[model samples]
Target chain A: MDEIIRTENLSKQYGELLAVSDMSLNVRKGEIYGFLGLNGAGKTTTIRMLLGMIRPTSGSAFIDGKRVFADNHELWKIIGSLVEIPYSYPNLTVYENLEIILRLRFISDKGSINRVIDKLKLSSYRNIKARNLSLGNAQRLGLAKALIHNPEILILDEPTNGLDPAGIYEIRELLKVMAEKLGVTIFISSHILGEISRFATRIGIIHEGRLIQEVDTSQLDKLCRKRLLIDARDKQAVYSSLMQSGYSLSETKDGRFELLDEKAVRNPEVIATLMVHAGCPPTLLHVEEEDLESYFLRTIGIKEDLR
Target chain B: MKNIKATLLPEFVKLRRSGIFWITIIIFIIIPLMMGLMMFVAKNPAIAAKLGLVGTKSSLFGRNDWPGFMGLLLQSLASIGYIGFGFVTSWVFGREFSDRTLKDILALPVTRSSIVISKFIVIVIWCILLILVLFSTGLLMGWLLDIPGLSVQLFLRFSEKYFITSFLTILICTPVAFFACYGRGIIAPIGFLIISLVMAQFAGLIGLGPYFPWAIPGVYTAPAGTEGMQLFLSSYVILALTCILGFAGTIAWWRYADHY
Candidate 1:
C-alpha cells in the first residue's frame, strides 16, 4: 500500500490536559480521508502534529516515508495544509500574499500564481488587501496558497470556513477533482458529517481526544443501523399480528411499530404481504436508515436513542 | 543567501506597508530640527526669555555652537534611539502573534532560524537608516545656522562618537526581540523597553552605569571631558554577551516552543 500519510500512536499533552492521545491513521495514495469530530476533539492538534508544527509527545508521524521534525524541512515541499482559520498578512494584497507563499515554497513557476487565483475564483479580489476581503474570499486566498504548489498531499482543517453554500460546493468540486483526477491525497476534517460523507473515501470519528471509529465511506451504510418503520390504520392490530408472528416488533415513543430485525428490514415486502394477510393493511410502510449525522453521534455514543 | 532574500523581501514589504514607518521617519526628521530650533532660540536671549519655559530649557545648550549642537544630538540619539530601535524589533516579531499569522511561516521550507535572523537584519537596517538620517539632517541644520567653531577634525570626531553611540544602543535590541517572541505580543517587549530605560537612568545616577547593560549605551554618549562617565572594557564584553544571549534565546524559542 502506498501510504502517503501515516501516524504511529501519536500523542500530545499540555501541562494538565491530554489534548490528543494515541491517534493512529493512514491515508493511501489518492484517498480523501475525512477526520470527523466535535469541538475540542483533537482534530486540529493531530493536523498540527502531522505538519510538524507541534511536537508529538510519543510515537511519530510520517509523510512520504520521512519522519516529521523541525530539521525535516524538505518534507513540507510536497505537503499543503490549512490547520484552522487561515490568516495572512492583513496589509498585503491577495496576490502579494500568494506571492510570499510561492517564494517560500521555492516554486519557480510564476504562472502558478495566476492559475491558482483563477482556480479559486479569486481573480476579482486579487488586488485587494487581505484585511479588506470578505471572510469567504480570505478563505479562498488561504486555499489558493495551499494549492499553488500542487503538492501531493493536503491536510485541511475546516477548509470551508466562512464560505456560503455556493462557495462550499465549488470548493468541494475542486477538492474532488484534485483528488480523483490529479491523484492528490487529502486528509480533511469537519464537524458536519454530511459534508465529508459526500467525498471522503474513508472517515475517522474522534471524541475526547481519542479515535473512536474508522470506517470506509463505502461501508457507512452497513455500519448505520437500519429499521423497518411501519404504521397501520389499526395500530393495535398490527402490533398484535407482528408480535404473534414472532417478528419481535417494538413501539417507538411516537406510537409507530418498528422492526429492528435484519430479516424484517431486508425483506420489507414480505412484512407488507404479512400485514395484508392479517387484515391490517399498513397505511405507512417504509424503511428508515440512519443518516450520517445520527450514525456519527451514535458511533461516538453521544446519541444513544437513535441506535 | 537565497533564504535571506526570500524572508527579507516580505518583511520589508510589511515594513513599508505600515503607517509606523512613515511615523518613524517623521520623528527622526523632527529630532534634529527641534535641536536646531533650541540652538537658534538660545542664541537670541530675548526670544528665549519671551518663550518662557521653552527659552529656559534652550539655555541648557550652553554656547549655541557646533560643539553644543553635536553634544545635544549625541545624547538624544543614545536615549531616543534605544526606544526607537526596540520598538522596531517588537513590531517586527510581535505583530506575527497579534495578527495570528505566525503559523503560516512555521512549517515553511525556510528554517525558523533564517526567518528570525532575517528579521534581525531588517531591524538593524531600519535602525541604521534612522541614525544616518538623523545625522545628516543635523549636519544640514548646523550648516544652515552656521554655528561657530566648526572644524573637519571636530566634525569627524563627533560623527564617530554619534555612530558608536547608535551602535551601542542598537546592541541591546536583541533582548527586545526575545521578549517579543517569548511574551508573544508588543506590550511585553515595549514594556521591557520602557523599564530598561528607567533602570538605566537610575543606574546612571548611582555611578553604576558601566555595569548595567541598558545604561552602557547612554554612558558612551557622555561628553569627551566629563569625569567618571567613561565606559569600561568589561562594559563592551557585557553588552556583547547580552546580545548573544538574546539572539540565541529568540532562535531557540522559535525552534522549540509550542506555538499553540
Candidate 2:
C-alpha cells in the first residue's frame, strides 16, 4: 500500500530493438517520482508498460499491490494518466472530451467535468473543439481529462510538452499541490531535468532503455560535482600560486582557473586569501555547482560539452 | 452492462459530432433517389432513347415494375452495404488509431473489451439506420415514380429480404474492425474492404458465392431459383463463423495486443 506504483524488471522488445530493458522502479504514496531521460531513451515505453497500455516482454508492473493488465479494470480505477502528446476526439469540444473521460472513469458526479475544466484553467475554451484549440489549451484539455476522476495516482508523460512558460508554471504548481496537499502519488516523465528537480522528491534517470541512476532531489547538490572558479588580474601568477600550494586545478575555456579540490570549494575564503597573498587578488572567485542538466548528462555517460 | 453503456455513450457522441455521419446519410438517400430516377427513365422508352447510355444502363433492372425495383434495391444493399457499413466500422475503430486517441482509452476503468464491443454496437446501430433510410427513401421514390405492380405480398417479401441482406452485410464488417486494429488506421481496413468486394465478385462468377462471407449476402439478394445464386444452410453457417471469428479477433487484439 505504501508503494503506489512498482515495476519489477519490466521490459519491452520490438524485434531487434529493445525499447525498455529490465527497468525496475517504484513510486511511493504522495511522492512525485520524476522519470528523466533523453528522447528515445525508453521513457515513454516504460510509462506505457507501467500503465498497462503495452505488455512487457518480461517482468510486470503493479499498482496498489495489484498486477497490471488490460482486463484489470479495477486497477485503473485509482489511476489517471496522460501519455505522450495527449489527444482527444478532434471534433468533440473540450468539455465533451473531458466528459468522455469522466464517464469512462465511471464517476457518478456529472459536475466533475466542470470542476476539472475550471481547475485546469480551461473554462474559457470549454466550448472550443479539441482540433481548434491551441497547443497549450489542447494540453490543458488532456490534463483535465486525466484529472476529472481525481484519482489517487497520476502517470503523466511529458505533460507540459506544448505549454507556455506561464502554463508550465501553473501545471507544475498544480501537480505539486496535488502531491503535497492531497497525497496524490505522481509518476511523471520528462526530459527537462531542471523542471523536474524543482518539485520531485526523488528522480530516476533512464538511458538507453535502462535506468542508470536514482537519487533524492535534495541529494542532487551533493551528487553533482562542484568546483571553485577563480579569475584574477594576473592569471599566470595565480595559476602558479594555486599549483605551488598543492591544490588540484584546471583551466576553463574562458581562461578562469578551476579548483576541484574539496577544500578550495568548501572554503573559498581560503583560496581568496591565498590569491591576495600572491599579489594577484581574484576578480571572480565563486563556487559553482554542476546543474541538474549537467549531472544528468554526466550520469548518462555523455560529456556536457558534447550535449 | 454499466460499463458497456459508459463506453457506448462516448461512441455515439463522437459519431454525432463527426461530419462523416451526415455524409453517409446523404449518400444513402441519394443512392435510392438515383435508383428511382433510373426506374422512371426505364418506364418511358421514348425518354430512355433520348437519354443515351444512362437509358440503356437502366435496363439492367430487367423490369420497370415494383418487383424489379425491390430486387435492385436488395442487390444494391449487398454491395453498397459492404462499402457503407465497412466505412462506418472503419471509422468507429480506425479513428482511434488515426486520431492518436487509442492510448487514452487503453487503460481506462471501463474494460477494453467493453470499448471494442461498444464500437461494434455503434457500427451496427448506425448501419441499420442507413439501411432504414435507404429502404424508406426507395419506397418514397417508387411511390412517386408509380412504376406499377405494387402488392402487399411483394412489399412484405422485399422488406424481409432487404433487412436480411442488410444484416448479412453488416455481419461481415467485423473483419474490417479487426483490420482497423491490426493495421492501426482507416486506410488498411478500407483497402481490405475494396479487395474483398472485388474478390466477392470473382467468387460469385466462379459459382463459389455460397462459401464466401462477402458474396453470401449478394447471393441472398438474387431471385430464388437463379442458377449458382442459391444459398444453402451452410452459407449461413460460414458467414456466422466468419463474423464470430472477426468479433473475437477484435476483442482479443484489444485485450492482448501491445498498443503503442
Candidate 3:
C-alpha cells in the first residue's frame, strides 16, 4: 500500500501516565483508516502525535514519508485535522471562520471558502456567529474548516461528535467521496465501533494506551466470534443429545445451547436433525454473529457482560 | 514575513469582532474625559468646595495648568497603560486557550512563530491605538478647559514624554503574553498583571523602581530631577531585555510546548 500516514512505535508519556505507547500504524493513500478506542484509550493522544501537535517521548510519525515535527511548516500544508470536539472563534461567523483557515493555509482561491460552505450545507448559517450556532452546525463548520483547503490527508478525531444521525451520515458519505473520488487519505478516530465499521477501509483498536488489534473491515466478520444457538421445548434432552454426539457446547444466559464448532455453525440443519431425533424439536435455531461493538470490546479485553 | 502577514489578517479579523476590543477602546476614551472633568474641578474652587471629596481630590493638582495637566496625563498613562495594555495582551493571546481554539491553528500551514508574532503585533497596535485615543481626547479636553501656561515647546516636550511613557508601558505587556500561554487562560495572565502592578508599587516605595521592568515606565514619567525616580541607562536595557525574553518565551511555548 502507498502509505500516506505512518507511525513507528510512537509513544507519549505525560509525567507517569502513558497516554500513547508504541503505536505503530499505517494509513494508505485513498484509504479511510478508523482509529477505534474507548474513551481515554489514547485515541486523541495518538492523533495529536500524528499531527505533530504533541511530541512523542520516543519513536516518530511521518506523513508522505517525511518525519513529523512541530516546526515543519511545509509538512502541514497537505494535512488538515480536527483533534477532538472542534471549536471555532465563537465571535466569528461560519464564513469568517472558514476564511481564517483558508488564509492560514495560503490558499489562493478565495472561492474555496464558499465551496466548502456549500459542501457542508452551511450556506444558510454562513453569517451566523459560531457561538449562536447549534452544536450540530458547529460540528459542520469544523468539518468545513478541515475540508476548506482540500488537503490530501485529513486527521479527524470524532468528527461526528455533536452531529445528528443525518449529519453523521452526510459527513460519512462526504468522507467516503473524498477518499474514493478525490483520493484524500483520512485517519479518523472515534469510539463508535459500529459506525466506523460502516465506512472504514480498515480499523485499529487501541486499549490502555496501546494499539491492541488492527484488521481490515472486510475481515471483521471472519474475526468476530460466531456461534450456533439452539433452544428447544425440552432443554435437557437437547443438551444430552449434543453431549452424546461428542459436540462441545456452552449454555447461554437464556438457557440456550451455543456451539462454537465450525461444522455446527456452518450447518444448523445437522443440529436440527439431531434435536428432532432426540424428541426435542428446536423451537429456535440460528447462527449468531458477534457485532463489531462486541468484537471491539472483546479485542480490548473488556467483556460485554462485565461492562 | 509572508506567513506573519497571512496570520495577521485573521488576527485583525478576530480583534475586530471581539467585544473586549470595543470595550477596551470605550474605556480608554472615557478615561481622558474623566481626567478632564477632574482638571475642570481643580480650576474652580467654588464647585470644588460644594463637592467636598471631589474638591479635595482635584486639589491634588497643585499647578492645574497645561504642563501640570500633561504631566498628569503621562502619569496616568504609565499606570493605566500598564493595566490596560496588559489586559489587551491577555485577551489577544489567552482567548485562544480559553476558547479552545488553539488546536485549530497549531497544525496549520502557517508557522506557530508567525502566529505568536502576529498576536504580539496586534497587541502592540491595539495598545498604541488606545494611547492615541486617550491622548487626543485629553488634548481636546485641555483646550476646552483653557488652562494657562500653554506653549508650543511644552506641548511637544510633554507629548514626547507621554509617548515614551506609553511605549515603556506597552513593552512590559510581552510578559503578560507569556503568562497567557504558560498559564493557558486570561485569568492567570490577568492575575499575573495585578501582582506585577502591586510589586511595581512596592518597588517604587523601596526606591528600586528603575530596576523593575513594570516600574521603569512610571519612573520615567516623573520629573527629570525627582528624587529616587531617576532612571539610568541600565533601566532601558533591563526593560528591553524583559521585552525580548517575554516575546521569546511566548514564541517558544507556541512552537515547542505540548498544546494538549
| Per-model TM-score versus the true fold | 0.96, 0.96, 0.98
Candidates in order have lDDT scores of 0.91, 0.92, 0.92
Q: What would the per-residue lDDT of candidate 2 be over residues B100-159, giving only the tens digit for each residue? A: 999999878898899999999999999989999999999999999987999999999999
Pairs clashing within candidate 2: none
Candidate 3, residue A125: the lDDT equals 96
Worst 10 residues of 2 chain A by lDDT: A298-307
Per-residue error for B239 in candidate 1, Å, reads 0.6
- For model 3, residues A73-188, the per-residue Cα lDDT tens digits are 89988888888888999999998999899999988898999899999999999999999999899999999888888899999999999999999999999999999999999999
Output the worst ten-in-a-row residue range by lDDT, candidate 3 chain A.
Answer: A298-307
Residue lDDT tens for model 1, A171-275: 999999999999999999999999999999999999988999999999998988989999999888888888888899888888888899999999999999889
The TM-score obtained for chain B by all candidates, in the order given, is 0.97, 0.98, 0.98
lDDT of 2 by residue, A52-145 (tens): 8888999999999999987888888888899988998899999889888888988889899889998999989989899999988889988888
Kindly report which residue stretches of model 1 are placed more than 4 angstroms away from their true locations once superposed.
A232-237, A273-283, B224-228
Give the per-residue Cα lDDT of candidate 2 at A28: 92
C-alpha positional error of residue A21 in candidate 1 after TM-score superposition, expressed in Å: 0.3
Over the stretch B22-124, how does candidate 1's per-residue lDDT look in tens digits?
8998899999999999998898889998999999999977878899899899888989989899999999999999988898888888888889999999899
In model 2 chain B, the worst 10-residue window by lDDT is: B54-63
lDDT of 2 at A304: 58
Candidate 3 residue pairs in backbone clash:
none
